[model samples]
Target: LSTVIDGDRRMFAVTDFAGADGSAGLACDTSAAETIRAEHERTVRSHADTLDQLNTAVAIFDTDEKLRFFNQAFQKLWGLDSGFLLSAPSNTLLLDRLRSEGRIAEQPEWRRWKENLLSAYRAVESQEHWWHLPDGKTIRVVANPQPKGGVTWVFENLTEKMDLESRYQTAVRVQGETLDNLAEGVVVFGPDGRLRLSNPAFVALWGLTAEALKPNVHVSAIRDLCDQHAANSPWGGFVAAVTGFDDERRDRRGQIELINGNVLSYAVIHLPNGQVMITFVDVTDTVNVERALKDRNEALEKSDQLKNEFVQHVSYELRSPLTNIIGFTELLSLPATGPLTPKQREYVEYVGSSSSVLLTIVNDILDLATVDAGIMQLDISEMNIDRTIAAAAELVADRLDEHRIKLAIDATEAPASFHGDETRIRQILYNLLSNAANYAPEASTIRLTCRRLADAVEFSVHDDGPGMPPDVLESVFRRFEPRANGGRRRGAGLGLSIVKSFVELHGGTVRIETGQDRGTTVICTFPDKPSGIPDTPAGIRDAAE
Candidate 1:
């Protein structure tokens, strides 16, 4: 008898068991079909994930150039909607756009794609080309040969990359040109102690060029000299001598004696980097100037010593004779030397006057010598501007009356507070007022004005006399210069120079304005006192030069 087995769990079955009995029979193959369906779904999901992550567009095309599978990247790259089906027409759409633009550079080496499309498969390696997208973006395209008899293209946007490269090249070229054109020798070495680069000046200095500069020569060659002079240290020890590293900018300078008897000044700079850049400036001219200056200074020192001896000898010689002359003149003026005749009295008076003038000249010369020797010191103090001006004006009041000049004071409404040496300020004002009185024409109006400015007070002496010419304006403050006072009188010209020096010492300025038709004005401006300084007229400062 033959038996039937269930196929779902059957390990063995009897031969000729094809009977479809109701109790025992084979089941359908539903489990196998479900397994195969599950595998197909998993494969599709993996492919979709891979296509989504990629940056470049991917497409699988058929032999006829009809796109079979297009990823999302392809849609974004080509500005196409997902619903559009890719075909030969879509491929031709891109090609047609490229043809209309004709952007590819024209050259004899350039190949036409349409004419040799079929032969592309024979190419050994992938080919690259450039594309200018409609949106004004540049792309570098690479065509990869596919085993399936078609090509896969990938593009990398090269706009930013190309621009950066071009800029880098331009910057390097400019740096090279600037260094090469310089007269000073320049050498840049890498941290590894090799001659990385040098300028034309460096080559000229060393009698070498790019082809001649070998790798072995470096700062180490001068190690002995560097040790002797800290400044000459290859590592720039001299920078510490001149400036503190805590400061922002540091400069290191030293001199180098070359083998050929030439001396050079080397300036070594330490960059923020570990590398050091050294510049050699041929300071031959500077060295020569320094030697000359030294010689001149020695000569000046000797001359000053001689001047001191001469001053001492002259002072001794003049003092004894001056005392005798003054005593005799006074005795004669007193009518005690046996009642002198009228002519003798007049002669005695003239002698006295001449002697007094000579004394004044000697005093002026001594004062100038003291100033030149720096023996005169400034006595700073608070000064009332109006009081000083009044005192100075009083000294010249008699002269003003004698000349019949009109004198006007414009200080009643202005502030009179300032910080300066009282005596110096008075001297300055006295000199300026006296100069005006002497230079102005008879009966000319002299206006003395004082006013407060933003940070200083201005004192002015204005005259209605002839103004200065342009040529005289430039050197008016020079010592011993005479003014063209209507071609009438000449002055010693030292007054203005003294005024200028005194005013500048007190952190002030003096100015002169002169012209032919318009009269001359001498203005002196002084720094004002801070808010709470008291106003008081003090004693005058000692007069120097």
Candidate 2:
């Protein structure tokens, strides 16, 4: 029936009406019934609008299993058209459509699964399920039962959440495994001054049981255990750091020695998250090795000192006796002292030569001892290069003539005058010539060459004789290590050693060139202006060089 009431049009669906006496009657106002119907429609529209704005997909199915209402999110989540969604398809029909499109995972027992899912309409409580879709999406399906015999399905996408949880768990497992296999002891403490994490290595290093180092143990308790083993415990500092009471939150590293003779190196690190970590590594072997090496080095240095002192004492004692022997041999050879037979004169000559050779050996030893003591001062002066060379040759002339080896002097490239210790230069030249003459073949020519380079002077003594072997050349400059090597005779073996020492004192270098069947050449080079040696002892530096 339709009518105008209070200038407003109102309509109502009218059924058969009856009067109080069971007789046919006229229509009532029906305004109260119309008001209730209008309010119900406004409430339903408000609820539908709120549901449409939600992100979660929601669909309501009636007792007949047909979709009664759905929100906008439901359509978007399923990627379904508006026409199809508005047509109100059944829940089974929607599932089949999604399956056909490969959106949901395949079910082996499709019929049974569908029946169980549809059973939510008869259930009083809500049911939940997890759907792993073929498209790599995870959907949490909740079938919430309604009092009016329907089900409200909620599909919450949980793919990203599950992925994060899986990665976090994996990371935790990997960290645990890494710590368990490390050689270094590791322990972590929280800001509450309690232990948070510790590995087996930490327990073993501190000689504590696993039970004693369990989680949440206070730092003070661990300090007590440390004091029993370690000579100095660092736990007092650790407690302050973990409790946030330390003014400077800095990392520390140090070594700890145990009473049992073991040593450990430790490091304390502060993390940005207010956590502290302590690590320890065993260093007992390294410490022991260092101590042994130090002791051995000290013993070697003392032995060398004794050797130098012995050589100096022996040389000084022999000098006085040798001087008297040479003087008496000279007197006996002169006519004013006595006339002697040919055999007596020859014996005197032999005695004088033998005394001279002994004196030379003693003098060489004294010179070496002085150098070793770091007190040998060079008398540097300007000298004529040609005169120095001539004088050195005259000294070694008798040996060269005896061997029938000719001396060949080549000083065309030498400077007229050079600044150096003239006495040392003459001694250097004499030692070089003597070494060459000792090894030079009879009737062979020994070449002595001197050249002026850009900033230095070079002198070379070449001998035509069998050269030194590789083994002999290896220690050719060592004192007292003489090698015959087809030479005429062997003396004190200090010729090359003295040459090297004197040349170096004059700021010079010496090198040798030789090979099998090819003669040996000893070359020495001196700088133009020598860098004066320091007044202080330089024995260590000279020996090392």
Candidate 3:
């Protein structure tokens, strides 16, 4: 509506007029501008939210090097002031602030480092750098060049992840070292019948080139090399085991006499996931020792039996009182016995443990004496290998748990049944496990491996503990030579000695492989049928030599 005034405030008829583009034109343009502004705001807010959600710090700069945007994490990561950040400083200015705040380490040449880092501005792809800060932080920086004249910088903290990877690598190194120090030659074959891993012992024993031992080398090539060392080599059998030629696919073992007059006892282990492992050890000394002692020792032991019986009878008489002492100690340990002081209880515990150890040594001594007297005979039967191992592991479970140790049993390749004296076998397994548990580090695993061969049963106890030195390894199987070496406790060192005596009595073999940084492994091999080798007590003099 419009009003027209005549000469002097005179009223005319009201009328409405509009141009070609009226209020609608201005309103439409304003509405379109408002919608575009709102969309842009939403996009920026979404991008900002994403940046804020990330654990890494991120920032973007324009082509002119002026800071356009940075997330909250960016400010927090650099410990920068919000007021200074809001001023839209340049990249150089921000770096200057970081340097002044002692956030980054001092560069040998600041100008060159800054220039080299900034060269990513002209690069087409992403560039990365590691920043070691003075505050002990390690930042992995990635500079991604944007299509339109700018860079998006991402700063990630890899401190914890790197630390974990370092520890894992250390464990792996220890494992590799352990393998290298083994007395037995171990070679693992993948499903493809190619060598996957071999230890230094394998290389040295077979005269193989350590530098040339690599993955994916075919078994035939290895067989060809090994055949050169033997008169009638079992290389063909080894090839068959690797290729799964025998339909039965069971593990096998046998003795191979080398052309140089050396005898190596070998076992082929069928591993899970279509893998195979073969181990070899030179058993010439053990065979020679058995042969040398066989007839002479039998006659000597018969003569010594009466004297041994007298010693054992006294030992048996002493066992009863020792048992009573242990039982009474247990009774006194109970709270109902008395309200003892903490120190007193502790002293009692020490006494109890010491007495128990002494009693165990006495019992071991008595048992050996009985064997020496030819009064005990091994009752061989079909033994459940898995059950026996579980039983032994259970016996040591409390001690293992006390030390925060882990146990991993690998009997996947073991036979279901083995022929041996069940009690004695359990005792052997128990002693091995107890020794391993004592030495294994906190949170480390003790692995028990039982492998069955065509004619024998093999047991191996492995521990990821601070290993024995060469001298310790030499003396470990000697009676009364135990040094705790940071284990749970010190013993009379009769554990390995007993293991040796029992193993030899079964007409089998026992060998130890150990080193300082590597770890230790004790392996025992028993034939399927008892050799019926007569037993005689190996004297302390034998251990000394």
TM-score of each: 0.64, 0.77, 0.45
RMSD of each: 8.0, 6.3, 27.5
Candidate 1 runs further than 4 Å off: 1-41, 63-65, 76-84, 87-116, 119-151, 155-167, 212-276, 280-316, 338-346, 374-437, 443-464, 467-478, 482-484, 487-545
Better of 2 and 3 by lDDT: 2
- Greater TM-score among 1 and 2 belongs to 2
Name the top lDDT candidate: 2
Stretches off by above 4 angstroms in model 2 are: 1-91, 101-103, 118-127, 133-171, 240-248, 534-545
lDDT value, residue 144 of candidate 3: 93
When sorted by lDDT, best at the front, the candidate numbers are: 2, 3, 1
The digit string of per-residue lDDT tens for model 3 on 47-100 reads 999999988899998898778889988889899998898898988888888998
lDDT of 2 by residue, 1-545 (tens): 88887898776565675678685545666777888988999998999899999988999998888888898888887898888877888988998988888878889998899899888888999999999988788899999998888899999888889999999999999999999888899999888778989888888888999889887998889988888997787777777777866757889899999888889899999977678999999889999999999998788777777777887798899999989999999989888998999999999899999989989889988888878877899998888899999999999999988978899999998999888988888999999999999888998999999999999999999998899889988778877777898888887778888888888888788999998879899999998888785432323222311
lDDT for model 3: 0.83
Give the per-residue lDDT digits (tens) of candidate 1, residues 159-269: 788889989999999988989899898876555444556787876665454655656455443333334433333434432322233344455677876555456778867
Q: Which candidate is the best by TM-score?
A: 2
